[model samples]
Target: MSGTLALASAIAEMDRDALESLVRRRRPQAPAGVLDPIGLAAELLRPDSILRALSPLDRDALAVLLGLAEEPRAGLARDTDTRTAERVSALLALGLLGVEDARPVALPEVTNALRHALMTAGHRPDDLSTPPPSRSGDNASAPPAAPPSADSWVTAALTAVGQTAECLRVLRDRPARLNRSGSVAVASVRGMAESIGIEADHAAQALAAADRAGLVASGGSSLVVSERAEEWTESDHIARWLDLAATTLATIPAPLRAGLVREEPLAAIAAGLPERFPLLSEAESTAARRFVVAAEYLGLSSHGRLSSVAELLHSGERAAAERLVRDLLPPAAPGVYVQPDLSVIVPGPLAPADEIDLAALTVPEHIGVASTRRVTEASIAEAFSRGITPHQARAAFARVSLTGIPQPLDYLIGSLAERVGNIQVSEHHGDDGRTRIVVGSSELADTLTVDRALQHLQLHRVDPTTLCSRLRADHVLAALADARYHASSPRARASAKAATESTAPPRAQDAHDDLPEALSDLVERVFLAARSEPGTSNFTRRLELAIRDRVPVRVTAEARGQQHTFLLLPVSLSGGRLRATDQAAGVERTLPVNLITAVESA
Candidate 1:
């Protein structure tokens, strides 16, 4: 009862618009009659509502709030800095702190519920220290970092962009299955790492980030590259990297995000989380650690400091962030040098389309500021198996080559084109439904039959120039292509394309899509209900509430043509009369409810 009275008193001090705004921000639906001061106060004091209000608070604000709650009688110290003043003002606006006798004070019920919840969730009071100043505002500027070269980070960032593209390609080709927990299976993760030429941990982080960026999504039973992934891949390097950084800042858990946007040290975010959020679950702790490594690996941060681009993005200044990061990126190479040694050297980052085209024909040797790739017989054969014609391959290289194609490379392409399609894959006519592979010569047939990579097909040698397998024709052709045998079939290319496209998953519907409208409706209902009712009806309703709880109220009434005031315990209300015992004179009294002019809790 005292908690209700105290909270009601606080709510009464707020203007109607201010009260309605606070009610709307809390995540609960306002029931009918919530416009009453006591009714709204009770709802805001609920434990769930308190927790919802606490979520967006930074560390310093939370520290100040908890300090007020823990030592309510001691009162807060005078605000000496802009940061402290801002925090106190925020708390006051949230209604967590109310002005009482010109000093900030907390509601006992709200504070008690919050402290109990924290304690029950394993938060120890002694373990909580005065939280460090949040890096969210002017304090977000970090100390200057020691460096290698000025452009080293640009090289690092460019390489990460390329790696991300490679990772997306891997997922598109072979969608990974989900485990029981709905995360990518560990074996699939290992395979992805091996395919992308990175360690398993780094690959996992890349996958996590890609999922957050909407480049990857869940298929029915597995994870697949999203439909938007191709467009993202083909976008400019600056847009691609900025998308990753912005998505990461937007979707990561609040604790780690606070560290990032606040410019706190990444390494300390996880360790320092208990001081922010009470305690960290195992899953939260792992995610925080992984995020720390991934942020740096993605070039969004360096050492322990956040990059200026990330800071700008977190502040909702997308254009400024893009400009800052663009200034730091190295220029893209217009063309590559095609040397006679069958090696291509890229002096800088290539445009996305050119990079994709070159990757399709040449094997990457190194990928960095200056990349090196080689054109080999097997590489050309694989490209041919994927349905790239010799003429098309020549045109691709010529288009991106700064120098004319060297004669050695030209001769090699022609010879390799002639060798391709020397083997053909077709369906067998037998009812058993098998595939047949035929070679141009007995020597070629003998080599294909004994090849270790082709052994998985269980190819049975029927003659010097022929072999058969129980697998489908497309499967056999793909295996042969992967083995660099340059086998061709009409259905192979379509099947590969279908396999890639079929893995694109449907977009999941957001569960909270209608939350904003629901909150808006609740606010409107409360405001309308308050406005439509008369003051007499409100006074009568307050008397009914006080009578139901047997609480003392200050009641003013007109009785026998004279105004009288009484401190009374409201006992009952019926027959349009309020029955009560006057507390000051210790006497029973009854007043016509319609004649009661005012009723407020004493």
Candidate 2:
């Protein structure tokens, strides 16, 4: 039997409940009218609809479809194990597979469409070498493995979030330009890694995670921290981790994730893909490796084995996953150790507010296993330059310190407060649009002019009372501030401009497609036409086949209660009309599909 006929017969045997269940499973919007077995089968067999449905199926199901395509009737055995039976049933519901002679068979149209899609994607299954067997066995009867310690997972999660935040800060200060392909340059990633004090590979993974999480976005030709980053920064650690983990998982293509089971290492899954399965492109292979790295960073896996958190996330048990992570997170330390040596040692994860404040106030000396930050006179002066007052700085440290503020740190803040405003910068619209700068004394002005760190300011001394810079007032102010010379601007500090215009953060494109919706309207139209005239659906299918195959067909039509038959060379099918050349009359006839009673091959 032909594919269409075989599928139609299989559908015809289903009861209303079974038919409705199948229809709903495909997730098509409800049709305007009910669909009979034949109409549904014809709709499912349309080339475009079949291709769309096949693209997202898991690996085993697609493989089965491919196998059955070569031997439609005898490919899949009637006696399948429980797992295979389940896959067959899912394929049956989608109409990609149909039962024939009490055994499941692939729909020829679906199989052909899938093959074409594979070819378009540059996947040549025929030429693929046999896939290597996984070092971790794939047998069903294997005992489940224990999950890794939650402590290590939580630690890694915290590090990922922290490093990603650091990367965003660096990009925000100096946005990186993208290449023509809209990807960050390797040199730029390396630069960011150096800035964040991390390995280049870790930085690359963090940036990838940041992009997927919507914390960073493309700004035409460069990458900028997106507005959503502020919201993310405000969220607690658990929420932040969830955002990155979920977003990264969603971006991985369905094919790469197929056959991935809980507790299975992603590396193993990538390695075990059947050579006959669709081959990943070089870029795709790189992205696959990046995803594994991201998964590890997000605490979804450890030593290449999937964690319990990952399993919960994959199954869509997000609430449970959140709770699991919450429980697993290490307790936040109420305070940090403030040393007289001007170093702050975080014995554990500090409270969010304290961590954020301290990060702004001090310089990070170490990260990862043992987090530490240093408080220097220069650091304190820089903090003062950013509008942080002496009192505020003192309060922030005291609020989060186990040992009360040390004398040296207290003296540093007090001394900075006394001298902060001594050096002043103001906008000047004189000789050549220069910014006017006044220091505490000529000695200081002379010191500042020749200071190697402030050389970029190009301070041109005008007299003992004043100096000038060609750059804007804000530029000179920031340069002096970074040099640990507490400088203030009498005029309002100019808001910094972004390299590119700001835009809404990009949304993740991971939602499952409404697979059945592609066929819904077509089915509705065909269903309605069939209702007004019996066998209209079958006739339409035959007409489409003739048109596509460039074949002549015998068409029977009724007009004014009279029936006429004509041999037609089908030309086109569009807008519910079939246009064909009447072979006998040697003229074109455009027939409304509803008027056609039957169609058959000549």
Measured against the true structure, the TM-scores of the candidates, in listed sequence, are: 0.71, 0.73
Error of 2 at 372 (Å): 1.2
Summing lDDT over every window of 10 consecutive residues in candidate 2, give the lowest-scoring window.
492-501
Candidate 2, pairs of clashing residues: none
lDDT (CA) per prediction = 0.71, 0.71
Q: What are the per-residue Cα lDDT tens digits for candidate 2 across 1-602?
A: 34764566556555545555556555433354335445566666777667667655645666667767765545456335677678777777667777655667777777778778778876654432234334555776887666576665777888888778778767766788789997899999898887657888888888888888888888877888888887887777678888998887777655557656767667666665433245344455566666777788777788777788877888789999989888987667788889999999977667678877887788666556457878977677667656677888999999999999999888878776665635778999888457998765677777787889988887787888589988998888788778877886745433223442376667664444442554455444443544443233556656755665578999999999999899999997777778899989999999887888888779
* Collision count for each candidate, in order: 1, 0
Predicted structure 1: lDDT: 0.71
**Tens digits of per-residue lDDT for model 1 on 20-81?**
55654564545553645456656676777776676555546656666776776543664656
